[model samples]
Target: MKIVRSKEFLGARAWDAQLIAAMQDATVRLHWTDQPYPWHVNDGQEVFAVLDGEVAMHYREHGRELVAHLGAGDIFYAAEGDAHSAHPLGQARILVIERAGSV
Candidate 1:
């Protein structure tokens, strides 16, 4: 994983791409944007907290769509092994945390 040497210049609503490698511990990511994110899945469970704007968590299954929106200080969990999608609901900032499980 890329070591975050510092938290400098981490500003408002924007989309940034980060790749974490060989991380077996919990990690946190901050997102500030109002753009649609592509469908994807991660290797672990994730928690998202909307600290500023709004974010909608989307899931597609069996030809149906499910949606949930989170506002300021709202929190949600992303299931492991599920194809999930997310996008900012408004101009917003979010905190994402991923936990590491036993090997």
Candidate 2:
């Protein structure tokens, strides 16, 4: 398996929002590691899979951090209007899927 570190904070703050593309279509894949970001709910649906390590996903509507400790083969999905953030709890690799033109 390929391992990717979270480079989201490389040239910005820990809270800076960054999105790394994986697969873009009706389903879009984005990867992130070593950082936390804030996001707002848009028009498309999204799915998150932890390719490696652990991450804490916070959703605005939930009002709590969904500390998703994902490893290989783990997955999570968030629907439309689900405002959230992707945060690396450790050295993490996450796969995010969303619709095109939604971000």
lDDT of each: 0.66, 0.62
Candidate 1 least-lDDT 10 residues:
4-13
Which structure among the candidates has the greatest lDDT? 1
lDDT of 1 at 44: 75
* Alpha-carbon shift of residue 53 in model 2 (angstroms): 1.0
Candidate 2 stretches with Cα past 4 Å from truth are: 1-27, 62-68
Q: Rate residue 50 of model 1 by lDDT.
A: 74
What is the alpha-carbon lDDT of model 1 when measured against the actual structure? 0.66
Q: Flag regions of model 1 displaced more than 4 Å.
A: 1-13, 17-24, 61-63, 99-103
lDDT tens digits, residue span 1-103, model 2: 4444553333333332245554546644445456766667757787777766677676655575455555666786778877777667766656666786677
Which pairs clash in model 1? Answer: 13-32, 14-32, 53-92
Query: Per-residue lDDT of 1-103 in model 1, one digit per residue for the tens?
Result: 3554222324443666232333558766666566877887767788777777677888766678888877887898776766777777656666677765411
